[model samples]
Target: MQIGHDAIIIGGGFYGAAIAVYLVRQRGLKRVVLIEREPALMTRASYNNQARVHNGYHYPRSFTTAYRSRINLPKFVQEWPTAVKQDFTKLYAIARRNSKVTAKQFERFCRDIGADIRVADPALRGLFEPRLIEKIYVVKEYVFDATKLARLAEQELRQAGVQLIYDTSVTAVSKGVDIPLQVALHNKQGVQELLTSQFVFNCTYSGLNQLSGDFSGVCSGLKQEITEMALMQMPESLCGLGVTVMDGPFFSLMPFPSCGLHTLSHVRYTPHMHWSDQRGIDPYEKLRGYHKETRVDRMVRDAARYMPELLKAEYKESLFEVKTILNKNESDDGRPILFEKHMDLPGCYSVLGGKIDNIYDVLEKLDEVI
Candidate 1:
């Protein structure tokens, strides 16, 4: 079967869905179809992440990223007020050794970004080991409920009349002789095709390299990491609080709004491993021989050094997924959203973003392209 639309958005995550909504409601483009390989939306990196709406504090290494996040954080919260948790008091601590940012540097970065930051109470600082943590600050950052956000997106998409096609994957993309681009899609019904009038947006995130394979040298700078987000049941006092250690090989234990639990992720101890090639990824094949939790004990051991309370938390299951990150230098830990327009074929663009709040940035960039 063959279908036609004004635009075809690959990957029905927040980025793809938001683009569809914008095209229809704001841009006046009709017949936007969002395609997702999963039977549901936000099943990959979108749902599996820490869900923190970055407020410039996470990227003390990248001032541009921190500043941009500070600008978009409020926009996102205002857009989906019900989907975000405003109750949590986020705690950010600078590591005493091997930290990426010094206490003063981090504070300076936060001040420059115009994000409010204050010292953690002296009594509250007693919860952490003095040798492991040098300084702590209470920052204004909140976690979004992934499931709620997805639901809100669906409602808005429906209201905008955006066609969402789940359980469908784009198998191939080719510049059509008649149409601008022809995208091959696969599902239970079998292979099909979609011809777009405007352009094809590749918002597949980690699947960008795989989806744009036929376009040579398009996603060459892309890399993938097999990362794990450990879910733990913590005390009530820590339920809504978020904690992240600064610099180096540290761990961030933050509230997971969707599951109502805390997610523990390490900077050095996490990332089971990273794989990068100009070619596409086969995550299942790559992880076939690997046990997801084999190294989780080590992660917990390392994280315990900073937050001893984590040792007392009950181990719930872990969510493991392949995260797509830009291949950048060590000094540059910033995650700037990537937007590649027409790598080799016209009327086709590939997009990848790290954080959900960055979706606003993605939409603004798309506006200029359109």
Candidate 2:
């Protein structure tokens, strides 16, 4: 079938939006359409993720993929318009712990990329707050508010004339490399067929397997619920400071002023205690409260650490959120898996596994492949 759209992006997250923008803006493709399941785009893995534009330090010392990723991210960030300035991001991943990496190492990594950073002494630990085990250097970068970024993409795409279909789930994808591949999408209409230029980018992080590429990693194995509470006052110091944490397993802090939830930060992964996707098995409940006693235990522990005096202060409202977590990460291979593969079909291509920093570059390559 000669398709209607020149390109149909499978998921409306950063990669998908970036791909759509690239196809239309850079490649001059007029018929671009983005299909999204959520009423608004960027609601899945991309939306819930910490929006740090990593400066390559997260990758390994000599890893080749890490080196390439580091080299590529800056070029991608620079592609954004002045309105999406490099500094638009609010949080930075400051690597400091009395552990594997040190302040000097972080500074060296920063210098390699010309990334701005502040070297600090262990005595000024509060400067890095929460994870202030020792005074260390902080490498800061503007963090993209995932939600805001998603919404921004939607508006920009619409204004630019990219047709966007929301609240529509892609039930089945027909893969091929021909001019237009027929895709089976299921939504309120039940089932329908849409043809697009065979170049399909499956930026769907959650449904990689569904797109025909078999990724060994599992997103459903682990889960997370981020509970955010505002500090009594917005500390002038913690605005953009974030840490991997001195005392916990993979603890991180990111501040968001754009979301208006900037008073404090949110926490993830409280030890072995795990949560679930709460898959539709339980009807009538959009959310699941933690097991009563487990909830109390976590509250008490969180309160004591975040606010020692929380035992006295009256608690306010709290919102519990859930998402899939990938616990099985290989060491120092932190570079997101970005690849272009055409499954058994001839015209369809799927792009998978990329971080925000490398999104533009990924799309550039994706277009070339198509």
Q: Pick the candidate with the highest TM-score.
A: 1
How well is each residue in 1-370 modelled by candidate 2, as lDDT tens digits? 4466777788887778877887888788788888887777776556545555566545534344446556665664565433232432232333334345455555566577565656554534543345533334455444556666776677779877888887776655554444546566667667565555545666665454443222222233333333333322224444334443322222344444335333222333222234443323221122344441223234435434542333343332333333323443334434444454554545455555546766745756766665
Score each candidate by Cα lDDT. 0.81, 0.51
Instruction: Tell me model 1's lDDT, rounded to 2 decimals.
Output: 0.81
RMSD of each: 1.8, 6.0
Using lDDT as the measure, the top candidate is 1
> Using alpha carbons, what is the TM-score of model 2?
0.69
RMSD of 1: 1.8
Candidate 2 at residue 214, lDDT?
26
Ten residues in a row with the worst lDDT in model 2?
277-286
TM-score for each model: 0.95, 0.69
